[model samples]
Target: MEVDYSDIRVIGFDADDTLWVNETYFREAEEKFAELLEGYETKNKIDQELFKMEIKNLALYGYGIKGFMLSMIESALELSNNEVSQATLSEILNLGKEMISHPVELLDGVEVVLKQLKGKYRLIVLTKGDLLDQERKLERSGLSAYFHHVEVLSDKKEKNYQDLLSHLNIDVKEFLMIGNSLRSDVLPLVNIGARAVHVPFHTTWQHEEIEEPKQKTGYITTNSLANILEYL
Candidate 1:
């Protein structure tokens, strides 16, 4: 089915993996986290426990490096039966700090796509994460000039998208979103009667992964961030 972008006036982009490196850092942190707890359990078990801890604490901590750090600390305590050394806990914190301080790396063609669409369309960033961290990354990305507004949402559910679009005075018919995660960035928009384009990242956080529905969704899928230009 052919999707139309001629009706799209405001384009929202997902920040993390769609514009720059994000999930890769989390994956790396998990690997190091597994190694830190290797004495207590197997790597696979450590990975599973940490993921569980993260989900269990999602409501309490929301999302971002701080929440992830806390989850790692909790997972370490449980995995080690509270015998995990204080030094080990500190090291886990360092892993998150390193991630927080990690430099932003723009994905290929991000600039070209944003630049071409900046003036022609109303560009905005509608990503979900810790506000401070997302702001820091956006400042580092040097792409802020392109977006008219940036929102750091707590979650990307259908209601969230509806409220944001309403608040922004953007009509659903004129709104389009593009991102790397189908679950967060694409599906919600589609569910809310807006258009979305999916550009898969090389690595996606397991939490963000979702199986495609058997029924057809109007959302379009493109191979790369640049590929969506063909649709736009």
Candidate 2:
């Protein structure tokens, strides 16, 4: 089905993975974390347990590297029967710091697309993560000036997008969202009567994976960020 975008007045972009490299860093950190806890359990088991701990603590710690670090620590303790060494715990903290301090790496054509769409429509960032960390990344990305506004949401459910659109005084029919996660960035908006474009990144978190139906509508998918320019 051909979707229409002639009515879109505001475009929302998901920051992580969509504009810059994010989940890749998390994958690297998880590998290191698994290595650190290898003595307690197999790498496979450690990975599984760490994922479980992250999901379990989502409500308490929320998202981003800090929460991931806490989950790793808790998983280490549980895996080790509360016998994990203090040194290992300290290393986990260091891993989080390293990730937090890592420079933001923007994907190809991110600025180009933003520049092309800047004055043509209202451009805003709609993403979820640690507020400080996301802000730091935006500062480093050198793309902040292109955005009219930036929002760090707690979660990206349908209601969250609806509330954000309402807060921005944007009508549902006049909004478009672009990002990599179908779960967070695409489906929710589609369900809320807004438009979305999916730009797949090479790597994604397990939590973001979804089953694409044989027949679906309400959104479009592109292979790269550059492709989104065609629709706009």
Candidate 3:
């Protein structure tokens, strides 16, 4: 229960999986799409190919409907060998958009923890995704009141972490980032001397996986979102 509150003015959080059940919905959709292509490709191959399309699209359109739509199109095209009908691609795009349009659901105990810390800390959301999509999710989650600011960026690199703190007029040491995804959330923040807590989700997106463990930062890992409240 020894959480550090010393000079920690701003607490940054990664939105997906941390605050709400995001990846599950996306995963479910991907699996459904994979089933559609089962006749053309093996499940693992479809997943691997779809993963590559997503990563490539992330660079082009960043996170959100735009990137996801492109991935759907690319995956469908790739699976069909450029012979897929426009009708099929249109259906896939529609499905993807429908998935994104769904309401956001806050994770277990997210409300309890946010209520506990809202008054004491400058809570900010620093999530990487489609700007409008992320914002819409935040608005629907009904937890936006607890956050002072919400940042939707293309990526969560070390530079993004450093730049955000600088723009916020806060020192790196005065911040603490809490969320899932070691690759996006923990490592970059820790590199700048900002403390971080890693709440590992059971199924992270392939692009978001950490290739190696970051053992040096002393970053705390929690099994559940509720467990985070005890630390804070």
Candidate 4:
């Protein structure tokens, strides 16, 4: 079924993978982290432990490189039974610092898509992460001027979308969210009577994965961010 996007007056974009290179850096960092702790555990074990620790620490720490850095440290300590050396810990911290300072690399066609839609709709950024880090990335991304507003949400749940839309005085029916995560960016908006377009990124964090509902109707999927321009 083709959903009408003719009513979309505001388009919310996800910041991370949807706009810039994000998960790739995390994947690279995880590899480096696993190599750092290779003496204590297998690479597979290191990956598993780090993911488990991250999930365990999500609520307490929220999301960002800082929380991920802490999770890596904790996972190392647990994997090595407190035998993990201080030098390794230092390296882990450095890994996160690298990610925080990494240059923002925008995805292909991101600028074109944004540029084409700039005057046609109210463009806004609705990403979930550390506010400071996200702000820094936006400043570095060189694309801040395109968005009417930017929101660094702690998370992207149904209530989060609801509150933001209501607070911004945006009509739910006229709002459309475009992003890389079905769980975070797509389904929540769809549940709130808002439209959504899922632009799947090449890589997705495990926690962000969800079973697509059999009754998907309020949203549509596109091969990439650029493809969404056709429907809009």
Count of clashes in candidate 3:
1
Q: Flag regions of model 4 displaced more than 4 Å.
A: none
Q: Indicate the TM-score of model 4.
A: 0.98
lDDT of 4 at 71: 99
Worst 10 residues of 3 by lDDT: 210-219
By TM-score, the candidates rank as 2, 1, 4, 3
Residue 28 of model 1, lDDT score:
96
- For 29-115, candidate 1 gives per-residue lDDT tens digits of 999999999999999999999999999999999988999999999999999999999899999999999999999999999999998
lDDT of 3 by residue, 108-140 (tens): 788988888988889999998878788888889
Cα-based TM-score, every candidate: 0.98, 0.98, 0.92, 0.98
lDDT (10s digit) by residue, model 4, range 96-126:
9999999999999999999999999999999
49-72, model 2: which lDDT tens digit per residue?
Answer: 999999999999888989998999
Q: By lDDT, is 3 or 4 better?
A: 4
Q: What is the lDDT of candidate 4?
A: 0.94
lDDT value for model 3: 0.82
Per-model C-alpha RMSD: 0.8, 0.7, 2.0, 0.9
Score each candidate by Cα lDDT: 0.93, 0.93, 0.82, 0.94
lDDT of 1: 0.93
Give candidate 1's error at residue 200 in angstroms: 0.4
Winner of 3 and 4 under TM-score: 4
Off by over 4 Å in 2: none
